[model samples]
Target: MKLLWLQGLACGGNTQSFLCAENPSVSEVLEGFEILFAPSITWDRYEEEVVFHVLKEEVELDVFILEGAVGDTRRICRRDFEDVVRELAHRARYVIALGNCAVFGNIPARYSREVKGLQFRFEKRGGFLGEGFTSRAGYPVINLSGCPAHPSWLSYVLLKILNGKRLELDDLGRPKELYAHLTHHGCTRNEYFEWKVEAEELGRKEGCLFYYFGCRGPMTHSSCNRILWNGVNSKTRAGMPCVGCTEYDFPRENMFKTEHAMGVPEELPLGVSKRGYILISGIAKTFAPERLKKRLIDEG
Candidate 1:
C-alpha cells in the first residue's frame, strides 16, 4: 500500500506518539506499506516538487493519513492545503484522520474560525470534507481521536486495515475495537468510584477522580484503561484524571474540578439517568465500605 501522511495546523504530538509505539514497533508497521510521504521522517528524502507531483496525482495513493487541523486563517494557504487533502482523499482507498486535530479540529479549532477538521469539527458533521464524503473504498474517515492518540491503538487500526478487514466504526467514525468501551471501563479507581470516594489531591492513589476532579472516564469513550498507555498504566491509574481527551468536547474548562448541579454531577455516565445516579450514589455512600473510606497507608 502507498501511504501518505500530511499535517496542517499541528504540534506534531501524534507523530511523537506514533514513533513511541511499542507493541508492533514503528518500523514493523511501516514495513508493510510504501511510505510515499511522511513529513517528519521522509520530507528530507524527497523534494517539494515530488510532493507536488504526488498531490497532482502523478502517483498512486492507497492510504491518506492526515494528522492536523486543515483550514487555517490564511485563505490561500488553507485553500491549497484543502485542495491537496481533497485530491488525496478522493484518490486514496482509505482515509484516516490520525489525531484529535485532524478528526475534530481539537484545541486549534478554538483559536481560529478557519481551522477545521478533515471530516468533522468537534461534534458537528461538516468540515473541510463534506459530511457525505467517503474514500474510494466507500469508507468514511477513520478517526483515531485523542490529544495524542494511544500508540498501540494506532498500530492496531493500521494492522486491521492492512489485513483488508472491514472495521466497524462508531457514530463518530472511531474504530469499535478501540473506542467501544469507556475510558473508565478498567480503571483501577473503580472501587473508589463505586463508593463515591473523591480524590482530595492530585497524587492520591486511593480515591476516584469523578466525584470532585473532572475525570470524564465514565462518559468518555476510549479503551484507555483496557488497553493501557505505554503498555503499563493509564492517566487514571497514575492518579491523574481522564480529561475526556478522546471525546469531541475535550479540553473543557475546569479540568481538575467536576461540574455539578445542586450537588449532583452535571453529566452522569453514558446511560444512567440523573435521578438514578443520585439515588444510587446516595445508597452507595450510605453503605460505603469502612476500608475504602480510610487512607490506604498510615503517614508518618
Candidate 2:
C-alpha cells in the first residue's frame, strides 16, 4: 500500500498530531505502506522529488489522505484542491478525510462560502463528493474529525486496515470506533456537569465549563475526553471549554462568547430534545451547592 498525504489551506495540525502518535508511531504502522508523500515527515525523502509532477503511469497510490479545507481555488496546489481531491479520490484505493476541515468544511469554510472542506462547502451545505459519492473500492470516505485529530485515532485506523478488519462508518462517514464516544463520555468533569455547576471563570477547578464557557462536550461526537490528550488531561479538565472543534460549526458565532442564550445553549445535546434538556438542566441546577455558586475570586 502506498499512502499519499496531502494538504491545502491548513495550518497542518493533523500532521502535527499524526507525528505525535504514541502507540506504534506513524512509521511503525505505515511501514509496509510506501509513503508517496507526507510533507512534514517525508520532506527528507520527497523534498527534491516531485511526486505529483511525475507521470501518472509511473505513479501508484493506494491510500490518499487529505488534511485541510479544500476548495475550487488555491493557495497551495496549482488548481483548486477540489480538482486534486477528486482526481485522487478516483485514483486511490482508500481515501481518508483527516480532520474537521477535510471532513466538514471547518474554519476555513466558515467565512468563505466559496472555500470549503474537501467534500462540502459551508454555504452550499455539502462537499464535492456530493450526497452520494463513494470510492472505487466501494467504500465511502473515511472521516476523522477534529480541529486537530487525535493521533490514536489515526494509528488505530491504519492498524485495523493492516489487520484486515472491516471498518464500520457512521452516516457522516466517520468510523464508528472513534466517533462513537461523545466528548462528554467518560469526562473527568462529569460530576460537575451532573450538578450543573458552571465554572465562574477560567482556571477554576470545580465546575463544568459547558454551561457558561460554551463547552460542546454534550453535543459533539469524539473520544477527546474518553482518551484524554497528552496522556493526562483534556480541555474541559483544564478549565477550558471543548469549543466543539470536532463538530462542523467550530469558532461558531463568537470564539470567546459562551454559547448560552438566556442561560441555555442554542443547541441541545446530540440528538437531545430542548424540553428534555431544559428539564435535566433545571434538575442539575437546583442541586448545585452554594460553594459552586459563590464567587471564588478570593479562593485562589
Candidate 3:
C-alpha cells in the first residue's frame, strides 16, 4: 500500500517515535508499506511532488497519515496545510491522525484560532475539518492519540489493516482495542492506589501518583503501562505523573498538583461517581495495610 505522511505545526516527535518501533521494527514497516512521503526521512528538492499528484488524482493515495495539527501558519499545497489535508482526505482510502496534535490539537490549537485537529479540537467535534467529514473509506480520521503516540499502536493499526482485520473504534474515533483500557491498567502502583496510598513525591517505587500528584492514569485511556514504551518503561513507572496528554483537555496548568473539591479529587476516575470515590477512598485509607504504610527500608 502507498502511504503519504504529512505534518503541520509540530516538533516531529511522532515521526521520531515511529522510527523506534521494536516489534514490527522500522525496517519491517518500511518493507510492508510503500511510504511515498515521510518528511523526516524522505525530503527531496521537490519535497511535495508526490503530494501534488496524489491531490490531482494522478496518483492513488491508499493511506494518508498526518503527524501534526493543521493550521494557517504553515504553508503547503500553495496556501495552508489544512487545504491539503481537506483535499487529500477525500482521495485517501484511510485517513489517520497520528498524535495528540492531529487528533486533539494539543499545543498548537491552544494558542491560535487557526490551528486545530482534523475532526475535533479539544472536546469539541468541529475542527479544521468539519465533524461530518469522512474519508473515501467512509471512516472519520482514525486517531492514534498521544503526545507522541506509541509506535506499536501505529504499527498495530497498520498491521491490522494489512491483515484485513476489522478495527472496532470507540466514540472518540480511536480503536477500542487500544483505547478501551486506562493507563492505570497493569500499573506497578495499582495496589497503592487501591489502598489510597499517595506518593509524596515523584519516583517512589511503591506509591501511586494519583492522589496527591496529578496522575491522570485513572481516567486517561491508554495502554502505556500494558504495551510499554521502548518495550520496557512508561512515565508513571519512571516516577513521573501522567500529564493526560492523550485526552482533549491537555496542556492543563500545574500538572504536578491535583485539584480537589472539599477534600475530594475534582477529577475522579473514569465512571466513578464523586460520592463513590469519596466513600471508597475514605474506607481504603482507614484500612490500608501496614506493609504498605511503612517504607521497606529506612533510607537514613
Task: Give the alpha carbon lDDT tens digit for every residue of 1-300 in model 1.
Answer: 888887778889898899888868998988889887776767555534555778555688888889988885323223476777788798888999988999999899998778888889989997788899989888999999998898887788788878999899999999998999999999999999998888878887889999888899999988889978788999999999999989888879899888899999898888999889999999999998989978889785
Candidate 2, superposed: residue stretches over 4 Å from native: 53-55, 72-81, 122-126, 259-262, 289-300
Q: List residue ranges in candidate 1 displaced over 4 A.
A: 43-47, 73-79
Kindly list the per-residue Cα lDDT of model 2 for residues 45-130, writing each as its tens digit: 65224444522454666778888877745533354556767777777777888888888877777667666665555424458676
For model 1, state the Cα shift of residue 136 in Å. 0.6
User: TM-score per candidate, in order?
Assistant: 0.95, 0.88, 0.95
Residue 157, candidate 1: alpha-carbon lDDT: 77
Which pairs clash inside model 2?
119-127, 119-128, 120-126, 120-127
Q: Which digits, one per residue and each the tens of the lDDT, describe model 3 over residues 69-129?
A: 8886566658566777788888888899999999989898888887888888888887877
